[model samples]
Target: MSDREPEVVRRLSSYDVTRLDTAITVIQTRDPALARILKAERDVLRDHRNQLDAFATRMKFGSAAPWHPEGVMDWLIAQGWAPPKGLLMAEGEQEGQVDR
Candidate 1:
């Protein structure tokens, strides 16, 4: 993680589903296992917080967003995927720091 702002923003925003395939392509190149996890968890990411918290922190969910439980959820929804239910977020959740 550059721990750099603009690079972080770029990485975080790359998760937008509009560019998801491309992003995952990049992900696959870097970490095939995490890419597999991402493929498996595409629509149901929020529930696996512990493993996600661990794996994600290892994988660096962008190397951008912090992978705390809520932060992981934050990244999920920010990617343009709908939240499962009841966890709907307010706008501007992406204003904070993140990396990939």
Candidate 2:
């Protein structure tokens, strides 16, 4: 095997995401299959936003954490994985509201 084979990716910077998004957008406009697949994914995520957020909260805080629609990324951020945008907290906010 080649030593330069791609390693596992841990994260993508905003620039990397922008590049992929540009390509995906272009392809999605030209290809119906990819567009449909992306649409389905979006629809499913939108439909189950509450459930995913709940599941992720459970993963981080066990069953005690009340299920609020805090968004999936919000729950993920509490568990140490955050998106490029990070949490939308006010200045000096030390912890998530749900963490209480």
Say which candidate scores most in lDDT. 2
Off by over 4 Å in 1: 1-16, 43-100
Provide the lDDT at 46 for model 2: 48
Q: Report every candidate's CA lDDT.
A: 0.55, 0.57
What pairs collide in candidate 1?
Answer: 62-99, 62-100, 63-99, 63-100, 64-98, 64-99, 65-98, 65-99
Question: lDDT of model 1 at residue 55?
Answer: 49
**Per-model tally of clashing residue pairs:** 8, 0
lDDT of 2 by residue, 1-100 (tens): 5757447522233454355456567778689788667666555544455455556556666545455335544666775665565546666776545544
- What TM-score does model 2 achieve against the real structure? 0.27
Cα lDDT for residue 68, candidate 1: 58
Model 1, range 43-69, lDDT digits (tens) per residue? 343333344455456446445545556
